[model samples]
Target chain A: MSFLSFLLGEKKTSASVAKDRLQLILINERRGSSAGPDFLPQLQQELVAVISKYVKINPDDIKVNLERQDSLEVLEVKIEMPQPEASA
Target chain B: MSFLSFLLGEKKTSASVAKDRLQLILINERRGSSAGPDFLPQLQQELVAVISKYVKINPDDIKVNLERQDSLEVLEVKIEMPQPEASA
Candidate 1:
């Protein structure tokens, strides 16, 4: 029976199976420290302080996202500033 | 003269100046390894191979992006699969 089943293709495509496996691995890694470094919040706080010195901004207005591509890691910081006054 | 200059605000707003400084810092950081892990391409290739086993797919169809938000890092993998055939 096992031999006959092997001769026939699996009900699920190999791609779907591989995707499931990869998702599991990713979830496991997320549970570990692989998600991000401990200093991220600290960095965000410091950035807020520094930027606040010059511009009046809410802490929540700054969003920092780090993306790693190949050997390079890019730090993306997006700040939502209030619109400048209409006059002057 | 310097004291008088300080008394009068500089032509550029402090906010604009701060933005320039931050941009410079970000550019410098990009020149360093903060962008991503070295294994990204390898992982992408392996994923392509694995998925190809069950489904016919182009290597470029898969895109993996790792995002670090606060203390957690999320591995996001997006695969563009070809539409299924209509026939049963």
Candidate 2:
């Protein structure tokens, strides 16, 4: 399937973008660190300390991390996770 | 390295997030397809057709993708590339 066909139904909102930006930088600082699913909460808490200077952040809605990129690493920050049960 | 400290400096505008959503969906469809750098452009071109329905998009600003996650994959779509010389 083409990228467009795949993305056509998904929606993007403004608040979510702000959240993603918040997540990316946090991931960057953690670069070259040990890998695991456990990294997220610590990342989220730290994000709160800094981002509060710019805007009120809803912690439950944040996602910050180091995502693999074809054997490389990508610093990503987002407002949400793909809903687990909903997507499957 | 906490996630927030890394993200505080980088800025994310609305356009970028929409692009990210676009890329993620496209990447999902392309799942398990291949391992190569060549896939990006073909993905980008295809994304333009689908997203244009929502807004006027500048092709130069688009990046539709399949990024990696812990040796796994994460679909991504964004408005631009990290400017090579500017960031490095």
My TM-score estimates for the predictions, one after another, are 0.26, 0.25
lDDT of 2 by residue, B1-88 (tens): 2322332334545433322211222222222223324433454344344444433446776654565432223345554323223322
Please tell me which predicted candidate would have the highest TM-score against the true structure: 1
How well is each residue in A1-88 modelled by candidate 1, as lDDT tens digits?
A: 2222231223644332221111111110111112333333444445445444433556566666564433223344554444433425
The runs of at least 3 residues in candidate 2 whose Cα sits more than 4 Å from the true structure, single-residue gaps closed, are: A1-88, B1-9, B12-44, B69-71, B80-88
Native-referenced Cα lDDT, model 1: 0.34
TM-score of chain B of 2: 0.36
> Candidate 2 - CAPRI tier?
incorrect
Best by lDDT: 2
- For residues A1-88, could you state the per-residue lDDT of candidate 2 as single tens digits? 2323332234544423321222222111222222324433454344344444333446776655555432123444554322223322
- TM-score, cand. 1 vs. native: 0.26
Shift in Å, residue B51, candidate 1: 42
* C-alpha lDDT of residue B57 in model 2: 49
How good is chain A of candidate 1, measured by TM-score? 0.41
Q: What DockQ was computed for model 1? A: 0.02
Interface RMSD, candidate 1?
Answer: 26.2
